[model samples]
Target: MPRAVTLIRSTALSDVAEYAYAATAPADARLIFLAGACPLNEDGSTAAVGDYAGQAAKAVENMRTALGAAGAGLDDVISTRVLVASARQEDLVTAWKVVRNAFGDHDVPSTLLGVTVLGYADQLVEIEGVAAVLDS
Candidate 1:
């Protein structure tokens, strides 16, 4: 099946960033707005305490599961916002590296943020995503 999502890269924009600068989905596509996927295990505990990279990986894994349940996948994702609970740029970069590697060549548009705290105890990372899929 053909994907509805299209990632846009611009020659005018700097190519230093790992992901595309923008993306779009056709009007007929089904939009999937996923909740923030936290670094939590199935049992409700945080998966990686005090480990930014590990927590980011777990969050990406959870995001993938959520997308699959919604009849989408990483390739169908149009954009994402990654939240890391930290005041340090290094911490945010650590989390972003994991997420970027997870997406690989799909490289959807993304925003990385560093916040003071997250919802769950010992939670270090959360990923929010929007995916579009054609349903025909």
Candidate 2:
């Protein structure tokens, strides 16, 4: 099996991301798109209300569960879209910190969006991801 890893960078953007990703990955690779995951606990209740950090953590955990169902993990994620209800810079930074800690050294391509509200009344954050299953 052969694998390739590419890190896109540009002076215009501090974060690493390609202007455009490869239209098609290698043959035999399986692609997976997880649904938007919210900060809901296993009991079907919001994990944290008005707490970006806690919501971010729970959202990531939900994302992991969705990825696992598709035979993928956090490391396999190629891209992510994070949604936060608050547009405040401090709130955004705090949520991003949680995501960064979860990803650690792997800086997966991501887009963070700040919105005025979400589907749930108490939900503060949501996360979704795309992953590729490598051929063994």
TM-score of every candidate relative to the true structure: 0.98, 0.83
- In Å, residue 17's CA in model 2 sits off its true spot by 8.7
**Top model by lDDT, which number?**
1
Single out the weakest 10-residue window by summed lDDT for candidate 2: 15-24
lDDT of each: 0.95, 0.77
What value does the lDDT take at residue 129 in candidate 2? 78
Task: Give the C-alpha miss distance for residue 63 in model 1, angstroms.
Answer: 0.5
Candidate 1 local lDDT, 1-136, one digit each (tens): 9999899999999999999999999999999999999999999999979999999999999999999999989999999999999999999999999999999999999999999999999998999999999998
Which predicted model would earn the best TM-score?
1
lDDT per residue, candidate 2, 61-123, as tens digits?
A: 988888888777777777778888887978877887898789776577778889899887699
